[model samples]
Every structure is written in structure tokens, then in C-alpha cells.
Target: MKYLNALRNQWIAARGWMFCTLLLAGLLIYVMQSYVQLSANMPTRLVPYDLHLMEGPVEVGASAGYTDEDYLTEIAVADTQLHSTWTPNNVESQYARFQNRMTPALYAKVGNDLQGRLPDLENSERSQALFVEHTEALEDTVRVTGRLRAWIGSEQVEDRPIAYRVRYAFSDGVPYVAGFSVEEE
Candidate 1:
């Protein structure tokens, strides 16, 4: 109590210093509160106008049934669109293209692959056989699902492209004809 009284008396006497110290404490508190608020809001950051910047080009025709022509066509379309769009640099455009075009193409390819493979499996005694014995590789037998996003050029708007993505899968375990479809957002 005595030491507090002495400190109080000293502070009262040093009005200038006391005012400065109070101001500094208030400033420090304000700064800390602001920092806390900013951190709290970090997760709520706005989605980028262009999502394509973050996601790479969408892959198409990964299925075993996809012929070289189909693969080449898809790739050519994507490449041409990307090259022509002014906003190819924009993230959103890239993402939109992947979602709209590339994803659907991939799904189709997976379905085709499964359809082709399942018929052959019915004849073979080994259901687990990895790949076609003569032509295709063993790794081609496995069905896979994945999601990806890519940017594509807009024919109308050179500066802005579209962003898109697709989530799909193929599974033989489902009993019905194996297939792939886009997942609902």
C-alpha cells in the first residue's frame, strides 16, 4: 500500500510523462485488438476473381478407352483456348474452363474406359486381370477419380476467361455399369 501511494504521488507530479505512458498503453491495446480482428477474418478472404491461377490446366481423357485422336483433340482445344485468352493469366478464367469443358471430357473418357474393359473381363476367368493382355498396359485397368480446375480463353472476351472444375469417379464395385459423373457442389 505504501509503495503504491508513493508511486501514485510520483505519477501525479509527472503529469507529462503519465499522459504519454497512458497514450502509449492505449495505442498498444488498439493495435493488438486490430491484429486479433485481422487474424479472425483471415479465412473469409474473398475468392479471387480468377481461380485458374491457383489450379493448373484440367487433364482430359485419362481413361483406357480414350484413343490418341480423342486425347489430342481435347488437349488441342484447351491449349488453343488458353493461348488466345488475354486473361489466361487470370485465375478465374482458368478455373472456369476446367470445370466446364475439361471435367466433362474426362468423365466421358473414364466411362468409356470402364465400358470397354468390363466386357473383356466377363470373358476372362481372372476378374482381377490388370490390363488387356495384348495391347494395353497393366496400369490401364485401374479406374480413378479426381478433381481439377483450369483456365480457358473466352472467344468473346479476350481479357477474361472462364474458371471451372469437376469431381468425378469410376468404380466397378458398384455392380451396375461403371461410370463417372461430376459431383454436385
Candidate 2:
């Protein structure tokens, strides 16, 4: 009777201890799961980008070669930059006209060409570059042929428009005139 009573008491103690441990473990798991769900539902804060600018020679222009769109863009820019407003009366106006249209090296060459003609500058008018045709000479070079109309203030300078071809290159990271030639066509 004593051995049987001791065995029953030990079994009862072991069962009670196991039940208490299981209850504690379930509570701990529930608490941890609820904390995770609550944090996930909260709104997250976003961080902004930090872009600090530095000073240097601002790199300009597209790459050496051109896509179809790039080729058209260079042609348009070159036309605008090259079109000259004929300043017939003043040396300052003539110089300024070339200075505006041509690059530094180009200006040096064309300036000499126009230097002696400043006195007769008023004999001409502003040139309107009406684009006619373009041919890609190289990967980065374009030969643009166009009709050049001269307008003196409000009047046309001639009865017929002049045809001109300009060889332009974007090889040096910028679209610039390589050569200018006039044609009767």
C-alpha cells in the first residue's frame, strides 16, 4: 500500500510540472508573435537622397557618335549657332556676329576672312538656314546642305536663295563646324 501511494504521488507531481511548463511556453510564444505583428503594421519612415554638388569644368555635349535622334538634334543646334545676323555698319557687330556663331578656333579663322569686309558689312543681310539635306560622312560627322536666304531688315536680299554645305563634327564632345562651302545648287 505504501509503494503504490508513493508512485501515484510522484506521477501527480510530474503531470502538474509538465502542464505548468507548457502553459508558460504557449504564453511566451503568443507575446512574441503579437509584438511582431504590431511592429509590421506600423508606418515605415523613408530616407531622402543626399547629392552634394562639386565645382569643375561642366562637361557638356553628348558622346562622340550619334543615334538617329542625336544626329537630328546636333543638326538643329548647329543651324541655330551658325546663322549670322549681318551687321553691315559696325565692326563690333560683325565681330560679335562671328563670335556668337563660331567656336573660338573657328572664329579665329573666319574672323580673318571677314576682317577686310567689315566696311561693306551692311551690303548683306541676316542668313536664314533652311535645311534641305543631310548626309552622315562618318560616325560622328554630318554634311548638312541647305538653302541660305539673306534678309535685309524686312526685305529679301536676292531673288534666289544660295545653297551651302557645312561639314559638321561632334567628335570632340561638341557639334562644331569643320568646313563651310558654297554651291550654286
Best by lDDT: 2
Q: Candidate 1 has what TM-score?
A: 0.21
Write candidate 2's Cα lDDT for 1-185 as tens digits: 99999999999999999999999999999999999999999976422232245342333345523334445446644553344333345534645554455556666777676666655564655433344544434443344444555556777775444444455545455556655555665
Per-model TM-score, in order, reads 0.21, 0.41
Which candidate comes out best when scored by TM-score?
2
Cα deviation at 18, candidate 2, in Å, is: 82
| CA deviation > 4 Å runs, candidate 2 | 1-81, 84-105, 123-139, 143-146, 151-157, 170-172
